[model samples]
Target: MTAEIKKQKHVGRWVAVGIVGVIVLALLAAIGWYFVRVNPSVQQVETIETAFPEESLRPEAGEGDGQPVNVLLLGTDARGEGDSLLTDLGDRADTILVAHIPPDRESVQIMSIMRDSWVEIPGHGMAKVNSALAYGGVPLMVQVVEGIIDQRIDHVSIIDFAGFEGLTESMGGVTVNNDIAFSYHGYDYPQGEITIQGEEALIYVRARSPFSDGDYQRVHNQRAFLRGLMTQLMTRENLTNPNRMADILATISPHVATSDTFDLGTVASLGSQLAGIGNSNIQTFTMPTLGTGMEGSQSVVHVNWDGVEEIRAAFDEESMTTFEPPAER
Candidate 1:
């Protein structure tokens, strides 16, 4: 009986040690997750707000409640020695777009504003929309766009052309529906259904020399690329898989510069709502332009206000419904 009791005590001690070990390991794992995942996400949101101050213009929390939010997305090609970001003194706004996420978060409306189109720059006089940024950075760009559309913008996310590779590669390349057959940079892109790799998508939209519409067709191709990108990101398979998430995060991390107002928690919640939305629910259009002209040495395109106002009305129904001042020469 004494020997049996000793064996039982030894076994009990070992079992207690194993239980403590398991608990310690679990505690360590939770701490690791909090630091590696949750903390960085929170930091990302705070960093975004610090980057752009325009986020304050968003309707107050209760005012719009769950209404749609507007984001100004800039895809800049000004990547040189000192002009990598718009922070560079001479950088121009290459791509200007307004993305609207509705209250339900179920749908999104993306309106692309042509960079070269001429419009009134608030502090400065009339000039090409792209020139607004070169004049006064994000502030001037926001002022001009808001003045033209008569709507308050929520936030801004600026990404480089190089970032395109990350996005295309994240989804293992996106499939774009080409309207016509074309060749550029020694690569032939056929019409109908086609899959494009990271490098291919870059050259596909960057091809402006061969197209008849020139910049006009380039804008159209951009719209097509965005459509494909959104479709791929929101798919059911991509959202739930860890491998896809890692690729997406890797692709988005280095290339994206967003306004400080974006909350990661909000984005996490919004992602689920966005999954239900489709391309059909979203609207995409470009600002009207009158070819190109020379403002002394700069080649710029004049804005066609009539067409722009028509599209603006759809977003800001309260004011932009009609063009009161009308277009001028």
Candidate 2:
């Protein structure tokens, strides 16, 4: 009887130990997953360096005075193998934007440079702003934008449109108001308020053929999409969801190229203010330019230097100028 009792106690001890072991293993797995997903920047290594010849644009870093910060946003169309991010696909910058954060950091100014705008390319002569990236990569692209605006860009971020749909789906969907009814790319998007998924939102912004205004209308749509996306990202549910956060990071991780010194947490915190800026408070406009020009047989968009000064003054916070209402298609 004594031996049986001892054996029973030993069995119980082993069972308890097994249960504890399982619980510990589960907890460890969860922690590993959290780190892997949330701290993507930890694994962010600039492993791939393209052989594309580096052109000198002399991209300057932040002024270090804690004044305003300017960041150039580049949307690239590079595609194919070994080029998870944009590469040798003859990719052009489809869209370009400059975000100027004031000294107060309370408000942000977002200015979109028309891709078609012709400008003097540093070391490459005159060409469209988009072509600057294709012709000489990031370095020249930076120089072209800085030359036009007359203010040095502190940093830059390059984004890819390929995984945008996955990002939208992860958010459950995003909604925006359409001021005018228009149809393009086999999608009939009506006027007023409408919800959009990843694919539909892409179509809305990329629809240039159907509108008479062409790229002008497309730029407006891109701004609208960005606003809606920012709002969706800040919502109670999206902000808290670990899965959504992972998906959002995964979507952009491959395409984005930022300065090595950039900090993810700092940007996220600062972005909250920019995101909260109401659509009414924000202004969207394109750099004025002649329709198009030719550079020794290549077509390009001509830049309007006078308009460039107006942009510089606005970014400098020099004077209050009336913001032109966003035009609808």
- Per-model clash counts, in order, read 5, 1
Q: Write the per-residue lDDT of candidate 1 for residues 200-285, one digit (tens) a residue.
A: 88888777787876777777777777877887777767655545565566566566666666555455556667774565655555
Candidate 2, run of 10 with poorest lDDT:
45-54
lDDT of 1 at 139: 69
Worst 10-residue lDDT window for candidate 1 reads: 319-328
Top model number, lDDT: 1
Prediction 2 TM-score vs. true: 0.75
User: After TM-score superposition, what is the CA distance of residue 160 in candidate 1 from its true location, in Å?
Assistant: 1.2
How big is the positional error of residue 253 in model 2, measured in Å on the Cα after superposition?
2.2
Per-model TM-score, in order, reads: 0.76, 0.75
Writing each residue's lDDT as its tens digit, candidate 2 over 1-329 gives 69999999999999999999999999899757766776774354232343222334443444555566777876666655766454552436677987766666545566778787766776777666777767777666767777776667666776666656656676667787777688876788899878887778778877788777778778778777766776667554655566766667766566566654345655655665454454555556667665665777866666667666766776666322344523322
